[model samples]
Target: MKQSPAPSLPSAEAALPRLPDRRQSVQSAQTGMVVLKGLANIGGNAGLTALAAHVGESPAKVHRYLVSLMQEGLVDQDPATQRYFLGPELIRIGLAAMRQAEPIRHAEPALIRLRESLEVTCFVAVMGNRGPTIMRIEEPGLPVTVNVRAGSVMSMLWSATGRVFLGLLDEASVRQMAESELAAATDDMRALLPSPDPIGTLQREVRAACCASVRDTYLRGISAVAAPVFDFTGRVCAVITALGASGGFDPSVDGRIAIAVCREAHATSLKLGCVGPPPAAG
Candidate 1:
């Protein structure tokens, strides 16, 4: 009829994809994430009133959700102080989310211990796309001014974390990391390599000893020692680094800080399901 009414144009609403039903969405899950985010922002245990303020929820509402989260083992409240902190179930879930997520949840306790014992700024590093990058840090009351923090990329050939990555990563990965940095280096910087074997030898020793370090190389008066955290595949998935002043921090294998880092790394690796101690070396 009338050439089908001149072929009616498609409505703009019709061109758009249909959204899922709002009623089907779980609002509670979104609320849960908000509560978790609020807890993280608070950085530790908080009283009911403080937590409510942080999450912008009423105390009664926060308490109800906290009770539910506690039942699910996602949040915990201290019986003595009535303060809230994250719970163990969240740790398990976080660890399960990534094969190499030791540093995200499992390594914090060890990092805290190291920081307290060594009075240094200890951090966890992982191989980010750019290079070895800091993922977490725990420092003493008076932290030093090294400038690197979570997400800071260390030097592939110069920084302790980068050296650990260079030392422990597979050959192909090591080459890729180095080349990525080299490709970005200026001509003058490229000419500064000490020799052809400058980094190769260190890689060998680092792999053999299962750790690496760089002192007063990147930032004068700053030093770092990094020990490998192996995964079930025995690959160095991450590293624990303790950075401090030049003289106060030792990169030596047997030194106090090195031993602490190596110990924590090994323990975390074991927790991640790597074989224990290589059968005691016979």
Candidate 2:
């Protein structure tokens, strides 16, 4: 009789342990995204205990991850408050990521054009849960210039971009956002909203101010005009605004700059595949 054939060895693929189902894998990924996104939105330095509560995760689990993040410099703790904000490393990663996105890359040219045309500082801001974030800025050449640097966070209630964005969103949503998300206000923010009516008036004005120029308080001597920039989904993803010394921009010229800024924003939106019809001509 022929000898039995030697037993076959298990293949590498078969030798590996079986993986979890697709649904489980997807759930795990979604949970992780939620945690990271929530952390990013928490604003200034947050405590591990507070973060865990916010994310609805156990402190032990959050502590382990926070320690890991801290080691990698992706999160930092304030010595005074002992809370954590996004770390410099996270910002570096974010900048790198923004550089690779097509919408941001395309906005660069338009930002430069607006700055050159207006002869003042122009900023391109993207919507964030907190408010509008200054993603890019083309500073004016003047020695005494208003400096709004990249990553500056402007209030959705005070800044032009913030007003424009609030205008685009529905009333209920806007109120909900203001009350629920931005519940905590800074001293400056409290000063801006001396009464509740100003917020309502701003919202109503935002609705009427579409493709139009509106003035609101900034710092004591600074002012700006803003217009919305839509994305492919017809959602306003960004806003382009022109800022200058309060006295330097004449009302007539300011109107013209606002119109030009709006026009350019529309053009940029179209290039980005915004589905909505072009904003009514200014």
Candidate 3:
């Protein structure tokens, strides 16, 4: 039988295992970068789970890496919530890195312009464990207003700004965060929520509006509109929100204001040399 035709050689393509698409491989890498950068910016244990899901990894594996990071002092744990945060090493790293980040430096002026344009209370907030921490606030020109000051911490599950920030995060991550906070919160705190489904529903709405602008009604008589702000890598770095008296500013107006805020934020990002996908136009 001519030794089975000398045993035909396998083709080069057949010799190799099926490889993942190059585009998919690139996306996987990018996803990992996004998760890492998000964790660095947000600085919380909940972020690890989010990052893991974003990269299609298990939380335990992510936790192992985080633990190693902690051992090296690149991360720390919060005593109150036992959540992890960027440690002293990261503080040093961030200080050095931020030197090249002009957007963060110019955050105040951009926020000021957006506020002035909208003539509503505007806030520039950064992500945190509790929620978005108000880095700066521009009170509206109006006489009567809601006075939320800088440094005030808003609930990630409630306030408009916080919701916008949460919207930037992935669904599984948001759900994980909400559940963690809900578990930590008092019974009275849980009671304040609209319903058990609000967390998941709100998170879905927020993520769906990632690149697009979105608006929401918070307190009975208070409404605010917001847009997600991205950094050079197109990660949701911060959120700029416009708040107004529910009576004076109609919900429709809030939507318009969100469009304007997103535009201004995009301009600012451009000025700061941030390269990323432009915010969705209204």
User: In model 1, which regions exceed 4 Å deviation?
Assistant: 1-101, 180-194, 278-282
Per-residue lDDT over 106-130 for candidate 2, one digit per residue giving the tens place of the 0 to 100 score:
6788888977777878878887655
lDDT of 3 by residue, 84-107 (tens): 666798678766765666555566
**Ranked candidates (TM-score, high to low):** 1, 2, 3
Per-model TM-score versus the true fold: 0.60, 0.55, 0.54
Where does the lowest 10-residue lDDT sum fall in candidate 3?
Answer: 209-218
* All candidates in order of lDDT, best leading: 1, 2, 3
Cα-based lDDT for every prediction: 0.79, 0.70, 0.65
For model 3, which pairs clash?
A: none
What TM-score does structure 3 among the candidates reach?
0.54
Per-model RMSD to reference: 18.6, 15.8, 17.0
lDDT of 1: 0.79
